[model samples]
Target: MELIDSAARAQQALEGELGGERMILNMGPSHPSTHGVLRIVLELDGEEIVNAWPDIGYLHRGDEKIAENMTYTQFIPYTDRLDYLAPLANNVAYAYAVEKLCGIDVPPRCKYIRVICTELARISSHLLGIGCFGMDVGAMTVFLYTFKEREKIYDLAECISGARFTTSYTRIGGLANDMPPEFLPMLRKFLNELPATIDEVDKLLTRNKIFVERCRGIGVISKEDAIDLGLTGPNLRGSGVEWDIRKAHPYGGYENFQFDVPVGTAGDCYDRYLCRMEEMRQSIRILQQAADQMPDGPWNAPEAKIVLPEKKAVLTKMEELIHHFINVTQGINAPPGEVYFSAENPKGELGFYIVSKGGGAPHRLKIRSPSFVNLQAIPVMAKGHLVSDMVAILASLDFVMGECDR
Candidate 1:
């Protein structure tokens, strides 16, 4: 018997026992339910799922290979496109790798700014995660509520840097510029108002019987399986393992911030949702503390050769103008070395590995995207579940194709 026929026969028999029809279905590569360009091949007996396989790489952009020909600092802009929802996390990860290779310390104020922006990105990401998850469940009202809060975060981000999304604010050593005087007060207002909004979301979904019934025991994975499948972010935490790059590895002064890591006992969709909710609050807490303790200092690193000369200096000093022109035209020259740096992105661990050849371009660069890693577990989680439950599983995984296929 052929494998396909045997599988079909088995499905038919199961469907006969259940008094329903059996079919094979492709969930995505084009379906909105998949979130990104992911395809899940599902074997189903009526609405009950027999097995599932995840097909990826539909949106591959060759980003890693493109990084190989660009300089370390020049690669920052490209990083913004991956996981477009949290570009600063990507920027910080790539810059931290280059900084690690050069052995330079970021200023205290700069560290605070990085923390603030990254945490804001985390909140932004969680909002989308919750909103999209709600959409998957046919609850459009929850989506509106979650996205309404998301807009406030985006507006705050836009106020800080001119751009709302894909704000390339992190430079090699520090921020592109200092925070505006009004930025702090605005953020304080946001922090004060966000908790109540979060409670509203919780009231709508967290305790609802239908939402709980759909998510509670479905798509369960053990801690060992989650680790084996390379799960991270809320997915890994949902399995009751407390492994956060910020808390475990402590990059970009995350050690200085006081925050709690939320964990869940049952590795299911409901647990993942709750973990994200707790994380949003924790991100707000970190932002509040960082805002209070923000220090005063020069924004960028003091390296004339690596950092761009001041605009005022460029206008007055002939040498500064020449340096500025050269820096802009040719880009920064990184030392001949390789480094791998990872950050606690909202999804999971977003890592950048760069190989420099002491020139204006990188010899090689590779990105360890969390979306890619987290998406791999879908098949494992979706197997033996109802076909209707596949949507719940995918929503829980929260795979973004931009980051996955990059």
Candidate 2:
């Protein structure tokens, strides 16, 4: 009877006393829950989070500073490192920013091709996001299904840019080259095959009791908080704010395509995951329309001063050769002006602000990275949730530290 009484008291002490003692825990700079060099300092009372603080800057990437020192033309490759998962989107966004400063619009063909590139990048990003999100929440089978589709995207990227990763495929006023002849049929085949994989993934996880229980009503943030926190992309949209830079202010032929922006009703982790899934479906529609309406014309702008001359002309004609030499030695002659351009990147809004002083390089450069902004909402959303719930929340936010650190 004395032993039984002692056991009962011990259980009560663990249940009540331990819950009252506060503890400070570090989630990472290298832990899986924080994901990619992010550190979150958590104040916990037993298993529940009382407060959380997110720490960044583990990468030490100085991409903005690099842009200020180099020629405008020289910075295209660096943008690829921003959202390394969506390098094509980064390339296009950077190109648009520079083009705005130069005050030149690329050809219709160029605009259409850029749309294709950006959309492809979007699909690829969302695929990896969904796959990892499933795996993060214990739906491991979904990861394999999504990656199979991603490989085809890599194949497409390789075909177009001659590199599957970090495709420095865009210039200030145009692309590296026109799309290869084989590209369209390949794209069509991919589009046809992708939906089935998406359906398979959807069936596996969308209503799975385990996934729903883990994700639903977890890490919720209000619409007001999202906007006030300056959230963009799926995080912002998941909060039911209907804002997409592509729709609000369309650039690079996005206006021509007809597609709906996916918005979530509930501002929770599950909503964010739903937004990404619907977004991929919308991307497929946009890709089909862009492919169908692919314009026929010069892929690059005709401006000799802004766009590089044809290689054959550069080799044969003295005037063309001079233009080529000037372009290679000195960058495009940008006027003294400041411009800010933001694109609806897969992660969110990737904005570039450039101040040019009539020179090859920018006088000032700043990047408004989505991941950095999205990470700000962690403390607000994470409070009052269990420590284990963080894995699902972080994966749902779907941030890449490459861009966040940059």
Candidate 3:
């Protein structure tokens, strides 16, 4: 009884010595680890996180409201700024959204071209994501390797779209122009070299002791939590959901290609990284399929009223001239209706809902950015983990503020 009383007194003394008030930490709208202008207010019990509040809106430019005022075609450039990492994919998603609203189907060739662009965008995006994930986890070699391949993708983007980063490549009805003659050859060469680079990166970080220890079993989100929290993209799949927007709702001719969605069993940071790595490989497969099955036809739809006529005809013919003038002065005349179309972007399901009141501009334009949805899961995932693990968690999420804040 004397020893038991002493033990109880010792326990109380230890608790009194060790415990204190919780701390409130600010992680930044400028911290490099945050990946962009994202700030998180973390409530901490020493180094362990008790709760997290993601404070977004630092990079907001009112993109949705801007879309309501501008023409659909005019807003294409703005889409580039949404997910700046995969501008081509953003352009494709927005263009498809407008096309769906207008009830127009672009030609088969256009669809295939779009698929090619979208997949390349996916590969490009995953490269940077994987590189940054490695960098955040202290694997610098992987970052260098992925960055080199990413540069090649940027070259391809510049070749195809005449803009490297914010590529406003897609149009309301089709592309700005057909693929340049040098594009396919360069793309083929890049594909040939890409696998080797991916393999190199895989060797560097896939089973690295430090990387694995830092990521595995850290920031784990259950499959149920992932779905309920509306986590999309790799973050969602990393939770073993297997809910890929491409496979579920094929867009931009994704149905024509065959690829696998990489789902994770652990739903941790390591699993998310692995999912991205595998996704890059699947994107390569889709790219190869698209290249082999390249179609031949008009790149743009034949709709004269909404689609601008060819330059040759516009100069010579009055009807074509008038259509061109209206297409330039105003935007395409979309029917009075509402439509929501989303594409499986590299980040996740990028959805655009348009409420059109029979005009060139939309009455309401709403963007469902995956970054925004995925960022919400941070609070749940970061709970009970050390503050240092926050870096890996944020990296695994791989979200950009451009789209999230927009």
Candidate 4:
């Protein structure tokens, strides 16, 4: 009885504003196509959407606040939970921010290793994005093929980080360890095979009548509005903006590599999909270059205070033992300052803003999550499109709720 009454009230409120001809519907806080716990309030005139409002925050874990309590190094694993699809990239972004705050420059080998890890993560993330996007649009075979490739990348990740999923492989001034000898050969094999798979997926979907009809010219966001909404990554690039954090800011030795950033003119779902596909090729190019020119040197910085000392040194030298003890217990004492660092994550620009008062823990930590920001444009994109078009747009946006609600 009460449930009926609440429904009556909701209908009354909706009707009062939108008239009897229009109906209000809730798409999801649980629907599979939403990709996460995203609820959209839709005002519909038959099958045409008159208005769409997105209600987020279902996956919020208070990640920034949690950073305040843990030491800089301890907070790395927490970053994995944000955009869990690209944990390696998240680890590097956070570590780079903290390193910048502390004025620690990682060794050449460490930089190249980080580049490899980050690019591998990019390919892995885009594979899932493309697969899931295809699945959302009824191309199940694409999902299967992309997942097969993604599993190979996951194997490579496990070889490098010793963890397939939550790889907290980066440290403040270096990596957790150097890449194993076998890792590069496996990566080369994956890279060599990836382009053909990309081409296959492209052939399957890029010109399919159903895919083109569903994706092309739908959920269009103009270049002006995309910039105004602060969209980044393939989403912004799909709108014909050439802004990529990797090229614009050039962190993690990205300046040393050469690659083209793919851009789209239409700013529609199809363009976004194409941008992701081409970006994968570019990532492969980066990985190959980094591998070819990788320098031979120490993987971690020699600064014992910032980076952990070698295990043998800790065992043999009293000073090394004390430094390890102090570092493990209190954390590295970063200088008092604030720094904002952003990396071109697979989803978008994953940024970390850190304020340190010369302590092991951050005074304040803030995350500029791309998913959260890009999600704001959904209403503008989905307005006037059919309810089904909303699904296509959301998939093309390629947002992860973990990062969106972080």
**What is residue 258's positional error in candidate 3, in angstroms?**
1.4
Off by over 4 Å in 2: 1-18
TM-score, one value per model: 0.93, 0.96, 0.95, 0.94
* lDDT tens digits by residue: candidate 4, 349-391: 8889898898799999999999999999988999889989988
What C-alpha lDDT values do all the predictions have?
A: 0.85, 0.92, 0.91, 0.91
Q: Show where candidate 3 strays beyond 4 Å.
A: 1-17
- Model 1 weakest lDDT span, ten residues long: 13-22
lDDT of 2: 0.92
The per-residue C-alpha lDDT of model 3 at residue 290 equals: 86
Error of 2 at 185 (Å): 0.3
Clashes of each: 1, 0, 0, 0
Candidate 4 residue 99 Cα shift, in angstroms, is 0.7
Global Cα lDDT for candidate 1: 0.85
Model 2, span 136-196: residue lDDT tens = 8898899899999999999999999999998999987899888999999999999999999
lDDT of 3 by residue, 155-233 (tens): 9999999999989998888888889989999999999999999999989988899999999999999999999999888
Best by TM-score: 2
**For each candidate, C-alpha RMSD in Å?**
4.2, 2.0, 3.4, 5.2
